[model samples]
Target: MGMTTDPFSLLGLEPTAALDPAVVRQVFQERAAAVHPDHGADAADRAERTALFASLNEAQRCLSSTPQRLRVLLQVRYPELAASHAGAVMDGAFMELFGAVGAALEKAKAVQSRRAGVVSALARAMLMADETMAADAVMGALGAVNDAMGALERALPALDETMRSGEACGPQLKAAAARAGFLEKWQAQLRAAHAGAVG
Candidate 1:
């Protein structure tokens, strides 16, 4: 199998969004060991094993993340539906969460800006209170984002059950993938902001 091979098939997993990341990692490790280039007998065999190992690495990377796994599963199972839902709008709850994260990030930026403008140690010390407040806000916002991500992860089992039951859940899978993508992005942003606020 090459890079374009189905990731679930490459990783020996059933195509479902409810996969546990730890299980995927374990499976990938086992498969990678079997195909490892170090076990190759000759030059040509080493090259072939190297390629296969690379493909396995790609598969593991895609399947180890909830968003990427969902996208891969959707594209493999419902290409047309996945393409159609590419630009689907996030629902109201995500919008609200996005707003909160945005606000926290802005506050952190403001604190960073003020801290940078202060050249004197006394001035910088004076700004510590505001920085602490900003840090607290960022931590709170990060907690909210984490909670939202957890909720999405908790819903994956039900989505898997729906698919297993032979119902059409491409739309739901697409929506969850979209939300996971946003949450992952926001989580990174919030983490960076928190670091800046505290640092």
Candidate 2:
């Protein structure tokens, strides 16, 4: 399939910002099984099945997350709007979470640096309390990120309703997608920091 192929169409779903992840998974599983290369009757058939299977997997990946799904929905339905808002600045709410995550990551890096400088076992042992505190801070930041993500997911259904009503929700959808992108990035960073602190 081409890059322009609509993932929702590939998965036999309507193009919408709100989709239940479980439903997407179930549909992908069923569709993938039917086109699986292993069941192909000949080499040419198998090759075709392989390509289709890959497209199905790509569709599943796109629809599996709220942010990605919203992006795809915008690209497919309102390409102009998506392009226009591509460089829009993040709103105040996301910036606050960004600050918290940044601080936690910095603390974790400091703890890791201190741990690295210690040569003696006793010195390393002495740094355990500091490492624990850093880990705790990382975990707290991760919780805040997750909470923000959850709130975004919860708002999707209403966003979908607005779109269905023929209202202009392009800006709202773009902002939500941008915020989700930030939260997703922060979650990864925080997890890595937590691992460094506690590993």
Deviation (Å) of 54 in candidate 1 = 1.3
Model 2 worst lDDT window (10 residues) = 85-94
Candidate 1: regions farther than 4 A off: none
- Which residue pairs in candidate 1 have backbone atoms (N, alpha carbon, C) closer than 3 angstroms, thus clashing? none
In the range 1-199, model 2's lDDT, one tens digit per residue, is 2555789989999988878989999999999999999999999999999999999999998899777888888888788997783564777877887888989999999999998889999998999999999999999999999999998898988998998899988888888888888788888899999999997
Q: What is the TM-score of each candidate against the true structure?
A: 0.95, 0.94
Alpha-carbon lDDT of model 2: 0.89
Tens digit per residue, CA lDDT, model 1, 1-199 = 2476899988889998888889988999999999899999999999999999999998988888888988998888788997783575788888898888888999999999998889999998999998998999888989998999899999999999998999998888888998999888888998899899988
| Model 2 TM-score on a 0 to 1 scale | 0.94
Q: How well does candidate 1 match the true structure in TM-score terms?
A: 0.95
- The Cα local distance difference test for each model comes to 0.89, 0.89
- In angstroms, the error of model 1 at 194 is 1.0
